[model samples]
Target chain A: MRTHSAIAEPGAIRWTLTAFAVAFLALFVALPVASVFLQAFEHGPGAYLAALTDPEALSAIRLTLVAAALSVPLNTVFGVTAAWLIAKYDFAGRGVLLTLIDLPFAVSPVIAGLIFVLLFGAHGLLGPLLSRHEVRVIFAVPGIVLATTFVTFPFVVREVLPILESQGSDQEEAAVTLGASGLTVFFRVTLPRIKWGLLYGVILCNARAMGEFGAVSVVSGHIRGETNTMPLHVEILYNEYNFVGAFAVASLLALLALATLLAKRLLGDGSHGGQGQPGASQEAR
Target chain B: MSVTVRNLTKRFTASAGSPRAPAVADASFEAPDGAITTLLGPSGSGKTTVLRAIAGLEQPDSGTILLDGVDCTAIPARRRGVGFVFQGYALFAHMSVRDNIAFGLQVRKMPRKEIAERVDELLSLVQLEGLGARYPKQLSGGQQQRVAFARALATRPRVLLLDEPFGALDAQVRVELRSWLQRLHAQTHVTTLLVTHDQEEALELSQHVVLMRAGRIEQVGTPHDLYDHPSTPFVASFIGGATVLRGRVEGTRAAIGPLSVAAPDGALEGAGLQAFVRPHDVRIARATDQSAVSLGKIEKLVRVGGFVKVELRLPSGEAMTVQMAKTELDALGVAEGDRVLVDLLAAKVFVEDYSI
Candidate 1:
């Protein structure tokens, strides 16, 4: 057998390469954001508080949270059922259906926003039917929700499908043969088996739901205190040259992102413990 | 409680590049009530397929499965009133040991308090009273298997089906569990069908052993019957370790390896016949001073647990194994390259040679 030397790489080469990679990341990914954060905190906590408590910013934050809350639950249900159908059975057109579910991931977010517009906006297909019933989709919170839903639709399914496929159908069959009804087996056995993957998918969905901007921006109409989400509000403040206010709001959203990541870590740790098989448990597999 | 499988057949359609093969072919058998019937076969021999078909997991191509004279061919597994203890135990990993045992009762929508009481009862019955709160993963393999058994027995089904119940255990655990299973069967008196490839397990655990090959039944009989009066060459070779020697038969006698023995008549003179002899029946004899030792060399000596296997090469160069006691090894003076004489006392005779 060939032996490996247990020495570290040459210090100069390793340090140089590490420095180069760090410099690249700092320049490309971290510095611009750090500059914004530094600028935001430079003024004081009072300015940050003012920006957050501003009625328009508050409404925008509330609207974004509401839309995400509404979308995540529905998407979770859809994600789990769709994943179950795809992973368990061999039905005709299954491949086509899987591709269609993943289509949202590949499609441009702008086009996803536009598709809702073309279908629900005035002078578009079904626009007359929508207007006759006074069903306001465009320039509305529901419109923002629909766009965000479309853009983030694939996260849960993508995260969950592979886990379900690897878990095999034996446990479910055993449950059924042991006299569990279909629903009982699904809830009692099947759900527990893939709870971690499902939770992981939901975390991804939540992350995407919070960060989604492009799709929501197009359909939101940006009514200052009404339809504006935090992201749209961030864009509006920056455009109006209120740099300090913009950065403050952006900091709040960044904190929310950080909180989500912490939650992901906490939930991930718990669910990893819940997995069944020793080797295939989440800690390793 | 009896399970009657009639003309049961199942064919799995070929997928992609695989050839279509019948998993089960026109299998039929009756497992009597309160008796343990074992389905014995090697892997992929359709033994598990027969069990699964009986459990309603696989739909047979054309057949009827009746449990206690009730035609259950179209019934679902849940309603068939059959308890299936799967290989690997299949205990719910998330539930505590007590809750796992109580799952069937809960599924039947039993009263919550009664379910709790039954769970406690089963935990004690399985000798796991203190481990009630422990999950399946925390228990040992044997404990997990007992919990699985208790879980199956919770519903009090008419029949019990075990698929290689102890196959996943270590040798010592397997032997201990085998006797435990026999005692459990005696106590419950539920009609049971166990499928296993280990002949020793089948012989020791079941009242009746159904020997299967190529998706068909070769023989079904008690362990003693199958071992002593095997109906075919397959049964003879499979049940007991016996070797066959080819020879020709006359009216009442046959010429075998350096010896002539009386053969059952229906043996055509000058026709070929095969004699079956167990290794233990072959005795080692000392050659007289006047007669040179029948020239057979000791090719190999293998020490098995309590017995030593002495392999001898006949003058005809055919190899045969003779078992000798460790105590008698000194007098026999058997060693590699030593010439020895073997005498066949009584041997089974077959009209034709059938070896697989």
Candidate 2:
């Protein structure tokens, strides 16, 4: 049988486009990251350790980690619940809910942060009430966490919704008929099926939460010891003319982004995994 | 457990651009304990709908389903103690064979040890003991079907329902599984209702066959009764491909196309009526020079199995078929273009007005 091999289209345009794309990516993406790392190592290993242990940089790293940890689980739970409702049920106002969930993604992060400020700032709506209640939202840890969460919320839902849709409702119904209670069926059958997708969603959410800057900057107030995250610290150091410290913080965030890329590769994008007993290979594809 | 469905009526409202077709209407039958009752019909014949209604997967407009004399109409599918093997086998793809079978037990909050023991028992019972670690996707089509059966039975339901269980399998697998299913049913003695459009399967496996058509039960009886003594013209034609011949009646004797048949019961609604004849019961005779035996000409002869299906055109230009055995065919030496005669022997006749 003569098969139409895709390899047969080894045209000049294909090779040219492939070369052009590789060259373009290397020049635009790979070079800048390599320069950052190369500069980070310009100082001796002792200077690198001293810069890493800087009190201001340490606080920023701790704040970013705390915010990401808080936001990732919250986003995960919200994403799974929303995805389940949208994918599994037919109800009124469903399209509106989906639009609202995706609205954060479409809207500018700066605008989103400004909206939170307008609602929680001193002269804004609910501002006086919050002050009287001593409930601080802007210029606080909650503000930074909330901003990051809003920007990162859609990652999990977007990744899991289509997976839930294609997995179908038959197996779950079969479990129900087998005398399994609702919770048991979810843990035993439904979770195993959706776990890989859920993990992918979580990884994306974590990456977004860790890297979020525009929204957090608008609300975080950038207090040195209290609220400044790594992105805000990087900007502060750059404005203060400490190029090495600024690049160092940026390098750490870049590393987190790199980790996310590696995670995605290992998991095979949730769809490419040899359909295993769902959660058995959660570490990788 | 025996299941009795009475006065079941379900009317499906017309969905855009199509006529309002009732999936099930006024259907009723009893599947006794330890017996396989098959609801046999064509694709749109409401057999599966009736089965699902009994399994509580479908909520009928009005009906009462009784399991062992207890009315279970209001009960949900989970509480009804009914196991359903879906057509597609709907196994949990994530779970291994052992885990799939143990799911119901684990949900019931059984002890961990008990769950494992019962899972093992089910695995061996389904003849999948060695493949306990395999996922549903890893198994062959037949093995997956057996796992599905085991998963359904692990709940220890009172009655088991299978909806076209072997429809997804190949012909050889289907036949092999049909015998295995029959043996499994015998060993477990669980009253089962299997819905199938395959008449051969229904005839071979079921103790009681319920033939349905157009949202109504055509006839319900033993397989022998349905095959041999069909009550309606539809049943006669649908069950075994019995051809109908229009005839004129005069008392007990009826004049068919170039032939005459005498009704044993001498029942008649009108002078003109229809006669039913099984192809196997009809005989073909070659023309003899001395005296031609019921003159006819063979229009087409199709060899099937050990018999040849002969479509003969009578002197009156009407066609009738006869299933002649290989030995009889060899002796008669009938060919497609040969001129012959057809003899109708002991064929049941019904009134033409009640044809459908």
Q: Please report, in order, the local distance difference test score of every candidate based on alpha carbons.
A: 0.82, 0.84
RMSD of each: 4.3, 4.1
Instruction: Write down the DockQ of candidate 2.
Output: 0.41
lDDT tens digits, residues B60-174, model 2? 8998999998999999877888888989998877678888888778778899999888888888888988898887767899999999899899988889999999999999999
Clashes of each: 0, 0
As for candidate 2, its interface RMSD to one decimal place is 2.6
> What residue pairs clash in candidate 1, if any at all?
none
User: How far does residue B60 in candidate 1 sit from its true spot (Å)?
Assistant: 2.0
Which stretches of candidate 1 lie above 4 Å from their native place? A1-36, A53-59, A114-143, A217-228, A271-285, B17-19, B244-277, B288-295, B345-356
Output the TM-score of candidate 2: 0.86
Give the per-residue lDDT of model 1 (tens digit) for B1-356.
89999988888765343546787788888999899999998788899999999999888899999998889999998888788888988887767777778888888899999998888887777778888888787888998899988988888879889999998999999999998888888888889999999999999888799888878788888999888778777788787677777788876887775755678667767778877777887887654432554556778888887788888787766777888787777677767877766777777777764333
True contacts kept of each: 0.42, 0.56
Score residue A82 of candidate 1 by CA lDDT: 89
Question: What docking grade applies to model 2?
Answer: acceptable
